[model samples]
Target: MINSDEILKKLAIESNIRQEEIPDIDLYMDQVIQLFDSKFMKSLRNEEEKVLTKTMINNYAKGKLFIPIKNKKYSKEHIMLISMIYQLKGALSINDIKAILAPVNERIEKENFDLESFYSTLIELQQKNINNITDQIKIQEHEIEMLENDDQLKQILFISALSNMSNAFRKAAEILVDDLLENNKKKGDK
Candidate 1:
């Protein structure tokens, strides 16, 4: 039942931000939904693009890719999840990605994970991952250098995407809550 304006007001009050300073919550909501439509279609990278061969597309159609979503258009949540999948496409097998994301899906569904804290923790983890790469380079570790690079890059990109997705959801939620409060206030005055 959440909507955009309520989300905006909550964010404003919670963050001690002026109402005018907040972006348009409804517009943000639209952007969030559209984010998936534009982004998910571009899921396949140049290397992974080839993997979308006829057989692979057929496999996708046949549910080999675990199409939890049936509609051609997907929601922000769906896009966020798919983004994670795309990130793993290069490093992990399809089954492996599914296994890795299983716990995440469960956690999100069960509300076991705090979205805000998760985003913050991911940034810290990304920093740690970078530090590990730097330490390796400083030690003149040439072995697995390519792997280190790929790992670091993937971690950075994945965390960045996750952070953005979290923000989108948070903003949308805040706006929705704010709108409800405003409506209630107006009704009380009437």
Candidate 2:
């Protein structure tokens, strides 16, 4: 059986690119790829998994997932947005991500948005939530351990419970995304 402590430690060690880690200057596509690879490689399940490829970056640019780049280079805000898209991709479709980030992109273009402060706040909130998540995991582990089942069965049950929770969260996120898109469309029509 996998220990809860081990799971918590793994969660703690998972990569989260701090605001300070991002370079102040704009980066070329190749440099962006290298940065992502270095920061996210440990989070990948296998060594063969690519973090961000040129094609993916190009597609994101074409798809308007982030603001347009200049001189074939990406800025700090671009990297932050790409990192957000990468995380959201695990639970949301690319279209969903685009819809959700539309307002943020618009703000960046139209207003003097403080993306650095926003990103820093987001990272701090995420770090704070880890304790809450680990607590939930510990509670779930205790519940699973109480059941009189074989070790394999217990593991399966634990995974199934986690999957159900993940599905619920994903559905909620999708609903919120839909609502935001609908509201945006309404505002556009006005």
Top candidate (TM-score): 2
Estimate, for each residue in 75-166, the C-alpha lDDT of model 2 and write its tens digit. 99999999888878989999999998888999999999998898889888878877787887888889999984688888888889888988
Tell me how candidate 2 scores on lDDT. 0.88
lDDT of 1 by residue, 1-190 (tens): 2222332333221211122322343323344334433433333334343322335333433543433544444333443444445445644556555555555665766766653354445445645654554443333323333345676664554445445655675566456545655665687799
Error of 1 at 91 (Å): 2.9
Candidate 2 regions exceeding 4 Å error are 11-14
Looking at model 2, residue 167 earns an lDDT score of: 94
TM-scores of the candidates in the order shown: 0.36, 0.93
Best-fitting candidate, measured by lDDT?
Answer: 2
**Over 4 Å off, model 1:** 1-67, 109-120, 141-190
